[model samples]
Target: MLAKRINGALRHVPAWPLYIVAVVPPVWLLWQGLTGGLGVEPIKALEHELGELALQLLIAGLCITPLRRFAGVNLLRYRRAVGLIAFFYVVLHLLVWLVLDVQILSQIWADIIKRPYITVGMAAFVLLIPLAATSNNASIRKLGGKRWRQLHKLVYAAALLGGVHFLMLVKGFQIEPLIYLAIIVGLLALRLPLATGARQRA
Candidate 1:
């Protein structure tokens, strides 16, 4: 069954494009950083870019199931890839802030502790770490389906936290983060009715 599924996924889409597409943004960032095209403060640009990418990827990951269900495309196969990429962006976001912006390890730790936005962002990223770690089929099988599903539900919290982080990160409360927040809420709300109905039936 697994082999058939793997073969079907490979036939459905080529993998190389996905990999290449994923690397494009970071490569661009590296080039910009080297060329000093990232404004007066390249570090700030790097931090902001990474955070935006993380948020964008988080939005994409949350949209996968809804898009699949609504469009009847069965693109859940791409969910893990989307999620892991999101996780990578988040790691980049945090690392740039820690290494470039904060410079001092103690300051970075203190910033995470003191700043509510950073605190939420770090929480979201930490939540993603486990999800990314268990993204592989082997880990999924080892954990069993039920446990795996439960663990993955952490994505909801991570998404919510990510949106909150962005909302707080903005210079002022902006519509962009609110829009992302609404989408996250709507996607999550879409799940509850069915789960509730199933329980009522049982």
Candidate 2:
């Protein structure tokens, strides 16, 4: 009953407001970086925060399917907004690395080629571009349901790559990155055919 009520209320809540709310953290991080509040390596701090935020948002979007299936909580309406917000942060993260950290175009290319984490991160970002571009009703209509869904499956790859990128970028067996990787793996496990089939038939 409580879930029903929450779902009903969500029907009236506009997704635009959520987008506005989602923009706050990145802006705040930027402001803090500009004001020396991000400690010694502000650029690195800002980049890390933006990438983490993107990962968090992607995980949140991934949760929508399981939430509706098991918890009776529906958030399908906000999934697109969540995804776009994730993509936006990803763009910011890449920009910071390219323009602020590396600055030199040749060095950026060299880093992407030499650094395994950067290569993985770039691949994940590249996968996300088509997904972000086709996230609309028009694209849905044009591509049809099955094809669109198949295309969006790129997200699973992106998520796994993102997790691996983060893990490798940390360069150690840090608990936090390990935890995030575990969560991503768990989420993927939940989406396996057996689990999804059982949930659907339930």
Q: For each candidate, give its TM-score against the true structure.
A: 0.87, 0.95
Candidate 2 residue lDDT tens string, 1-202: 9889999988888788888998899889989998999998999999999999999988898888888887899998999999999999999999998888889999899988999999999999999999999999999999998899899989989988999999998755689988888988888888888877864452
Error of 1 at 84 (Å): 0.5
Relative to the unseen true structure, what is the Cα RMSD of model 2? 1.6
Cα shift from native, residue 146, model 1 (Å): 1.3
lDDT of 1 by residue, 1-202 (tens): 5545654665668433665698899889978997988977899899888888888888888777665455444557677888888898888888888777889988888988999999999899889989999999999899998899899999999999998888898886579889988888887886685733544421
- Candidate 1 lDDT at 39 equals 77
- Which predicted model would earn the best TM-score? 2
Best by lDDT: 2
Regions more than 4 Å wrong, model 1: 1-11, 194-202
How much does candidate 2 score in TM-score?
Answer: 0.95
Residue 121's lDDT within candidate 1 is 90
